[model samples]
Target: MTYISRAAKILSSRVSADVVILGPTVIGEGTIVEPMVVIGHPVRAKLMKALGSDLGIDEYMDSISSGSQIGSNCIIRSGTVIYEDVVLGDNVETGHNVLIREGTRIGSGTRVGSGVIIDGETIIGSNVSIQSMVYIPRGTVIEDGVFLGPNVVITNDKYPPSRRLDGVRIRRGAVIGANSTLIAGIEIGENAVVAAGSVVTKDVPPNKVVMGVPARPVYDVDVFIRKRAEYEGSKAP
Candidate 1:
């Protein structure tokens, strides 16, 4: 059942009938929201529950929900849930079953693949490509033009179940390979590359290529680029 709030502003002609848009959510022009998508879902429900508020669910949600903003020309696939207070810039696309929590900001032209879970307070820059099954924890910062391959896991807690959470920062144009696990508090420098299945435990210098369980710099970005060019040139048309 579709539920669009009276205070919501939906300028898009492509929103599916089965979607639920609550609060003052804004869906911009030409955006396509697929079936089962829930935009501007209030996150205050958890807080209200914890506080044992006497207010009804709908009433409390309506009172505190600020709603999300989905920019123009974007595509939000099926089963995606964007919580209230999230902002998606123009042309941002998300694959099926993606979860973007509150306080997350996704810049324009970013493409998030299926099963991606972006926890609250994450900042993702423009043109970022996050492939399938990526797990981005809270406070993670991904700069422009970054590529996160399938099943890449970025953590936040340095010590398991600890109070302190430190997010990993992936600088501009960095490439994190498939199945790579980036430990908390590490920084992948600009244009750096983490080879497939690596477990990064520390900072990677700019333009370097790191690999292995405790990933170490093996070569520079120039070498990796040259090798890629050679491989592409060798392929038959």
Candidate 2:
């Protein structure tokens, strides 16, 4: 059993009874929030509005204040913290201790592993698999069926703390290997495979295999996939 705060907006009759919602967050029917999940933690809208008023840009505050929404049948695991204005589609699942920040939109059937931090304003497509300890910065776009291995770092800023930031875009069916680092503004094309421990600095073409520091295209991704399949088959019992 879970405790749902009276301030929470529960549109669903099937939510876990003990979850804590601190804002005007909406949870769709059939969504399951495990014990200790926190949704819509205070965004200080009023204070933000005041600051914006002082700065002569109060309209910015309005875009920042809408509460979060979880779609039907989504399973939010324990110890996950979702900030305000984040929208999640149906059947999305998150592992323990995941932190999803504000203004992000996650499509259906995405599985986010434990210890993942998805920063604000990210757009993630359906059926994406993001493994543990991956850091996705703000403004990133990940298309459908993308696979991100553990400890992948997707950067969004070319210069540290710069006013301008451009996020990396991963196209459909791209596979980013473990411990890979994608610098800001790089595009991983459809079906591209980034080898483990690679640092990608530029755009990777479709169906290509890239490896090493300042990653360079090594071969066709199909060749790598076939070799991988054969190796796995040989190891099978």
Pairs in steric clash, model 2: 2-17, 2-18, 3-18
Residue ranges of candidate 1 with Cα displaced over 4 Å: 44-60
TM-score of 1: 0.94
Give a tens-digit lDDT track for model 2, residues 1-237: 243445457776665556657556789888888878878754655554565364422223323445588998999999998988899999999999999998889999999999999988899999999999999999899999999999999999898889999999999999999999999999999999999999999999999999999899999988999999999889556
Model 1 lDDT tens row, 1-237:
577777889999999989888789999999999999988877755555635767765556655678899999999999999999999999999999999999999999999999999998999999999999999999999999999999999999989999999999999999999999999999999999999999999999999999999999999999999998999889687
Each model's TM-score, in the order given? 0.94, 0.87
lDDT of 1: 0.93
Candidate 1 has its poorest 10 consecutive residues by lDDT at 44-53
Cα RMSD (angstroms) for every candidate in the order listed = 2.0, 5.0
